[model samples]
Target: MHDAASALNPQALAEAAGAAMYARDTASQSLGMKLIEIRPGYARMTMPVRADMLNGHLTCHGGFIFALADSAFAFACNSHNLNTVGAGCTIDYLAPGRQDDLLTAEAVEQALAGKTGIYDVTVKNQDGRLIATFRGKSHRVSGEVAPVQR
Candidate 1:
C-alpha cells in the first residue's frame, strides 16, 4: 500500500473524479492551473502567470501564489474522498514570481488527528528554488465526499 500510486490514493480517486479532480479541473478554466501529481496526503500543481496575475510590482501576485499552494493543500487533504474544509492557513513569500515563469506548488500532510489534519505547502520555480511556503489546517467533515458547491 506504500506504492507510489497507492501512496497517492489513486484507487480512492480517479484522475477525473472527486473534489481534487474538480478543483484541478476548475482551476484550468478559472485559474489556468494544472495539477501535476497526487499521492496519499501529497499533491503538486503548476500554473503560468497571466498579465492579470501580476501585481502593482508587475510580478505574479502574492495572492496568486497562495492560491497555488492552497489548491494543492486542498487536494492533499481530501485525497481520502472525505469532505474537508480549510480551518486556517499562513504563507510566507521568500521570493517573487514573474508572468513568464512557471510556478510549481507542492503540498504534504504533516499530521492527522481523526477529523483534523495539518499540511505544509511549498512553491518553487522550474529551477526548484523555493518561492513560498505555507502551513494549513483542515477539518474533515462527516460525509462520503467532499463538500458540494451549491
Candidate 2:
C-alpha cells in the first residue's frame, strides 16, 4: 500500500518537520528565538538581545549567540525529517552583540553523505554586520522527526 505521506514533496516534508521540532523546542522559545524560515537543508532563526542576556561588559553573552546559531543548525540538519543531532560544532565570534540587537542566524547545508552532514551558519545583527560564523557536523540518528502526513 502506498503511504499518503510518501506523496508529500520535500518542501512540505521539511516544513512539517520544522513545525514539529519548533513546537517542542522550549529552549529556543524561552530565549525569544523565532524560526523564521525552513527548507530542505536550510533554516533561519532570529533572536533578540535583551538586557538580561548581556554580559558584564555590557554586551550580549557569547553563549546566547551560540545558542541561536546552534538552534539554526539543528533545524537545518533535521529539515529532512530524519532525526539528526549535532556531532560536533565550532564557532568564531567576530563581533559582540549589543542589547536590543536582533540577531539572525542562517544555516545552510554544505555537504551531506551517508549518515553525516556539514552545515555552516552565519549570525548577523539587524544592521547586517557579521557577528559570528558557526560550523556544525550532524549525525542522523534512527528516527523520523515527525510522522508523515498528507
Candidate 3:
C-alpha cells in the first residue's frame, strides 16, 4: 500500500490520509476502514460490524455506519489528495445492520470546485440490501503538490 505520510504533502493530503491513517484493526484505526476498491474519483470500502459497533438497540451503531461511509468518502475524494475534509454530511438510514455482518460503502464524486466537492455514498449489507445513503461535502484546501504523490 502507498504510504501517504511518506508521499503526500498538503496538496495531496486528502487522498493520502486514508493510507496514512490505515492500521490493522478498527480499534487501531479508530475508523471503520478498509480500502477495497479505488477508481478514478470513486472508492469502495468494507467494514465489519463487530459487537462493539452496536448501539443500545443491539444493532450496528449509526456512528459506525457513518464511519464506513466517511472512510469511503475520504478515499474517494482523496484518491489523489489535494487536501480534503468533510464540511458536512447527511445520512439516511434505510435499514439497520447486524453484528458479524460485513458492510460495504461506495462513494462517487458528484461535483467539484477548486475548493469544494460533493459526493454520494451508499452503504449496503452483505446480501446487497441498501443500509444507508449519505451525501458529503468536502473542502479541498489549497496546498503545494508533493512530488509524485500517491
Candidate 4:
C-alpha cells in the first residue's frame, strides 16, 4: 500500500485530494468560490464580489476576502492528501474589491517541513489589481484527505 501510494502521480494525487475536499466544502460552495486549479503545493480559487458581500463602505468585506484566501491556503496545504489545518494566518488588504469584480486568490507553498507548512496567497481582481495578500501557517493532523488508490 505504501509503495502504491508513493507511486501515484503527484499531480493526480493533488487533483483527487482537491476534488474530495471541494465536494464537502459547503462554505466555499455557498459563497460562490470556485476552485480554479490545483497542483502539488499550489491552489487557485476565484470568487465574485456580489452585492451581499459588501460592507458599510460598499466595498467587499475583509472577512470575505480572507475567507477566499484561507480556502486557497487550505487547498494548497492539503494538496499532498494530508489533512492540514491553519495554525495561524495574517492578511493585509491592499485595495477595496468593488462589486461585480471577479476576485482570484492564488496560494503557493513557501515551505513544508514535518507537520507544518507555510503558504502565501495573493488576492487579485479580474484586471489584475492587487486586493490583498495573505500568509498562512498550517499544521498537519492525522488523516488522509482521500484514500490512496493502488
Model 4, residue pairs in steric clash: none
TM-score (C-alpha) between model 1 and the true structure: 0.82
State the C-alpha lDDT per candidate. Answer: 0.78, 0.95, 0.77, 0.95
Better of 2 and 3 by TM-score: 2
Task: Give model 3's clash tally.
Answer: 5
For model 4, residues 1-150, the per-residue Cα lDDT tens digits are 234755388887798899999999999999999999999999999999999999999999999999999999999999999899999999999999999999999999999999999999999999999999999999999998988757
Quote each prediction's TM-score. 0.82, 0.95, 0.79, 0.95
For candidate 4, what is the lDDT? 0.95
Candidate 1 Cα misplacement greater than 4 A, ranges: 1-11, 14-20, 23-28, 146-150
Identify the runs in model 2 with alpha carbons over 4 angstroms from their true place: 1-7
Question: Which parts of model 3 have CA positions greater than 4 angstroms off?
Answer: 1-18, 21-32, 144-150
What residue pairs are clashing in model 1?
7-40, 8-39, 8-40
Q: How many clashing residue pairs appear in each of the predictions shown?
A: 3, 0, 5, 0
What are the RMSD figures for all models against the true structure?
A: 5.5, 2.3, 4.8, 2.3
When summed lDDT is taken over every stretch of 10 residues in candidate 4, the lowest stretch is 1-10
lDDT tens digits by residue: candidate 3, 1-150: 346565544434434455553542355256546787765468888888899989999999998898889878877777654557789999999999999889999999999877888999999999999999999998887752223435
| 5: Cα error in model 2, Å | 6.0
